[model samples]
Target: MPTATPSPDFVAALREYQPLVRRVCRLYCQDADDRQDLFQEIVLQLWRAWPRYVPQPDAKLSTWLYRIALNVAISNLRQRTRRPARVGLDDDAARSLAQPTESSAYEPEEMAALYAAINRLSDVDKAFVLLYLEDRPYDEMADILGITQNNVRVKMHRVQERLRRLLVPASTH
Candidate 1:
């Protein structure tokens, strides 16, 4: 069957929110290749869903995008973990990994530490972190996450505390 061409509106939305998708991928995937693959998967999923996406005035486009991206990332992670883990990468791959995927929000060292801590989090908590980092409003986060606003607030607090403990050294605590 012939594929439907993407609508101009879908193209526009993807262009505008491409960074958001990258951010989601960065938060979820540690490997450079995995990040890129996840990004492509996200874009494909977004394109496939675009026709059914009716923008509700109350729910922003980014929220819907987040919902799809996070679901894909979490599902992908689950599938990946079921397989045997890969060993160390080649020198070139390591060098590529050493480079920042995107302009980081924190300093290099701080970003490294923060990402390390975040890596330890559950996928759901990582979603919370992504939304928090994006400066999304709680209502929007809840909407994107398909949870109650109060659940979002509570989970966010717990996730923050978890991240804080993860970041703090035992000697300093």
Candidate 2:
């Protein structure tokens, strides 16, 4: 079957939102190859769904993009089987991992530990974390997650507590 081409508006929107999509992929995918695959799958799904999207005056485009990306990532993660552990990072990846971002408040090691903790979270919890980290308003997050604002608030507080427990060493408790 011939594939439908993405509309010009869709293409433009995708290009504009690519970074947000990539961030979602990174949060869900540990491996570079897996991230790439997830990114492609998200783009494909976005293109397929674009025709159905109706822009509401009060709705933000980022919220819509995030909802679709998170859904795709969560679905993809569930469908994937475990692969053999990666032996080592490539030179570039190693360097990147070792180097902390200049603007980041945390050291490289601290950031790595934080990411490791995040990776341990359940998919739904991870979605909560991602939305919170993005500084999304409660209303937008509730809409994206298809929950009430009160639920979003309750879940977010729980997620924060869980993350704190994960990050704190038992020896220190």
Candidate 3:
């Protein structure tokens, strides 16, 4: 099938915001293959939805970009059954992650533990965690989830508590 060439504006918008989509994909899909598939799906959905994108006078483009990317990443359910039984971390990737780079915030083992807990969260909770981790404003988080701002604040607090519970050692709790 011949692929429709993206409009110049579409091309520019996509190129400028791909990293945002990639980050969402990485958060949602642990397997590299699933990550690439989700990335492609997000791009396809964005391309299909481009005609409706009205550039408001004062709105930030990244906000709209995040909305669409999160929508796609959160809604996709077809690949759940196809997920591999075990996803192995590449040795080189693990080695690089362990190395203390200039910007390293946590040890790789801590990061791995964090990811393990995150993976165990429910899908909705995972969405909440993603937004919280990104430090999205309450209003924006509410808009993304179609909830009130107060509700978002409440839910955000609950989500954090849940994550804390998950991360706390069983013996300490």
Candidate 4:
């Protein structure tokens, strides 16, 4: 059977949402090459699923995007072989974690450590962290994760506690 081409509307939507897709890629992937591969795979899956997409008045586009992106990332993570754990930072790592000029939140080292801790989380926990960092509503997070809102709330709290343990100083603990 011949394959269906993606519609123009789908193409336009993907273009507009590409940054969101890339952000998902960044959250899940460590290396630049891996990030690119994940990005391409996500776009492929999104294109394949585009025909089935039905716009609902109550649903936001980002909800669908998050669902697809997280599912693909988790699946990809499962399929990959494990690599040696990395320790210490390099120039590339520092560059990637660089903060915007307008922001004076966490220092670069703190940001890198936070990201490293996030990377250590299970795929499901990482999804919770990603949605929380994005400031997604519990309802939308539950919908994207296909869990009850209360479950999302519970999981999110646990994930926050885990991150605190990972990022906080021992003296503060």
Q: Which candidate is the best by TM-score?
A: 2
**lDDT of every model, 2 decimals:** 0.85, 0.85, 0.75, 0.85
Model 3: what TM-score?
0.82
Instruction: Work out candidate 2's RMSD over C-alphas.
Output: 3.0
How many backbone clashes are present in model 2?
Answer: 0
- Give the distance in Å from residue 88's predicted Cα in candidate 3 to where it truly belongs: 10
lDDT of 4 by residue, 50-125 (tens): 8788898988988999999999999988777465544434567655855544654777777788887887788999
Candidate 2 pairs with clashing backbones: none
Candidate 1: pairs in clash:
none
Give candidate 4's error at residue 118 in angstroms: 0.6
lDDT of 1 at 65: 94
Alpha-carbon RMSD to native, per candidate? 3.2, 3.0, 3.3, 2.6
Counted clashes in each candidate structure: 0, 0, 0, 0
**In model 3, how large is the Cα lDDT of residue 152?**
87
Each prediction's TM-score against the native? 0.87, 0.88, 0.82, 0.87
lDDT (C-alpha) at residue 61 in model 1: 87
lDDT of 1 by residue, 1-173 (tens): 21588888888999999989998887777778888999999999988888788879788888999999999999998988999865334445444434554765555556566777787899999999999989999999999999999999999999999999999978997
> What is the clash count of model 1?
0
At residue 75, give the lDDT of candidate 3.
76
